[model samples]
Target: MRAVVQRVLNAGVTVDGECVGKIGRGYLVLLGVGHGDTRAEADKLWGKLRGLRINEDENGKTNLALADVDGEVLVVSQFTLFADCRHGRRPSFTDAGAPDVANELYEYFLTLVRQDVEHVAHGIFGADMKVDLVNDGPFTIVLDTDSL
Candidate 1:
């Protein structure tokens, strides 16, 4: 499992011109599932993200976690993160999980996130969607469960 976490002032996802999910003042996470990812990996990454302290404190120090600021989350599935581009021009997605398994894990991840955060928004899994966001501080973080 991997995730590209970006702090955003606001974010929204649209599918076929219809808005499906939206959030304000929180994270816009683009998550990917690898062939070997399991519930344990999902749980670990979710916990780490929830506790990550990137938001600024009253003194202007980056010391507040998402919970501390009572922020929301926008989770989006993105299997392309597992794309292998080291070889030829065309990237290979052999490391990405099958759609059936990936969708199950993606839903599980969102459920886990909702448990800790006040609000959680999500993009349609396996759909052609458009995502837009006002990146707060332009702060972004990448997390890979395999690294842990």
Candidate 2:
């Protein structure tokens, strides 16, 4: 599992001109499931994400967790994160997980997050989505289960 976490003032995802997911003062998570990924990996990744302290505190120090700031979350399935581009212009997606397995894990991850977050929104799995956001501080973090 991999995630690109971006701090945003606001974010939303649209599908077929209809808004599907949205958030405010939170993290926009672009999540990807790679081959052989499992619940354990998702668990570890969520643990790290839940504890991440990137939000600024009163003193302007980046020391607050998402819950501390009453933040929301917008999660989007993004298998493209696993694109293998080392070879040629056309990236290979062999590293990405199978669709059925990936969707199951994606839903599982969303369930885990919703348990702790007051508001959690998500994009449709396998849908073409358009995302818009105002990046807070332009802050972003990339997390991979292999490193966590």
Candidate 3:
């Protein structure tokens, strides 16, 4: 599993000209599930994400976790994070998990996130989505289960 999490002042996802999900003062997370990944990896990443001290505190330090600031969350499925681009000019998505399994894990990840944050938004699974966000501090974190 991999996630590109960014602090955002606001974020939203649209599908077919209709807004699907939206959030304010939170994180815009682009998540990907790769082949062979399991629930354990998802759980581990969720734990790490919930505790990440990426938000700014009163002293202007990036020392507050999401909950500390009562932040919302916007999660988007992004299988391209597993794209294999080293072999050729065209990127290959063979390393991404199968659609069925990937969607299942995606939902599981969302459920875990919802447990901690009051406002949890998400992009439609397998939909063509347009995501918009105002990045706060331009702070971003790339998390991969392999590196954790």
Candidate 4:
């Protein structure tokens, strides 16, 4: 599993001109499932993502966790994160998980997060989605469960 986590003032996902998911003062997560990803990977990444000290404290230091700041999270399925461009101009998505496998893990990840976070939002698993966010501090981090 891989995730691009961005600290956002607000974020929303729109599909077919209808807003599907939205959040405020938290993370805008572009999440991807690799071909062999499992619940273990999802668990590892979720812990790190939730504990991230990206929000500002009273001293202007990045010391607050999502819960501490009363933030929300918007998770978007993004198979494109696994794009392979090493070979040619066009990227290959063979490295991404198959639809069924990816969707299962995606739902599992969302379940795990929803259990812990006060507020959670998510995009449709296999939908064409448009995500928009106002990045707070433009603070972003990329996490790969393969590294953990």
Best by lDDT: 2
Residue pairs with colliding backbones in model 4 are: none
**TM-score on alpha carbons, each prediction:** 0.98, 0.99, 0.99, 0.97
TM-score-based ranking: 2, 3, 1, 4
Per-residue lDDT over 1-148 for candidate 1, one digit per residue giving the tens place of the 0 to 100 score: 9999999999999999999999999999999999989999999999899999999999988999999999999999999999999999999999999999999999999999989988899999999999999999889999999885
Please, what is the whole-model Cα lDDT of each candidate in the order they appear? 0.96, 0.97, 0.96, 0.93
In terms of lDDT, which candidate is stronger, 1 or 4? 1
Q: 4-40 in candidate 4: lDDT tens per residue?
A: 9999999999999999999988999999999989899
Using lDDT as the measure, what is the rank order of every candidate, best first? 2, 3, 1, 4
- The count of backbone overlaps in candidate 2 is 0
Better by TM-score, candidate 4 or 1: 1
Question: lDDT by residue for model 2 over 1-148, one digit each (tens)?
Answer: 9999999999999999999999999999999999999999999999999999999999999999999999999999999999999998999999999999999999999999998899999999999999999999999999999988
Alpha-carbon RMSD of each model:
0.6, 0.5, 0.6, 0.8
**Which runs in model 1 stand beyond 4 Å of their true positions?**
none
Model 3 worst lDDT window (10 residues) = 80-89
Evaluate residue 48 in candidate 4 and report its C-alpha lDDT on the 0 to 100 scale. Answer: 85
The CA lDDT at 22 in model 1 is 98
Tell me the tens digit of each residue's lDDT in model 3 across 1-148: 9999999999999999999999999999999999999999999999999999999888999899999999999999999999999987999999999999999999999999998999999999899999999999999989999999
Candidate 3's TM-score reads 0.99
Consecutive 10-residue window with the lowest summed lDDT within model 1: 139-148
- lDDT at 130 for candidate 1? 99
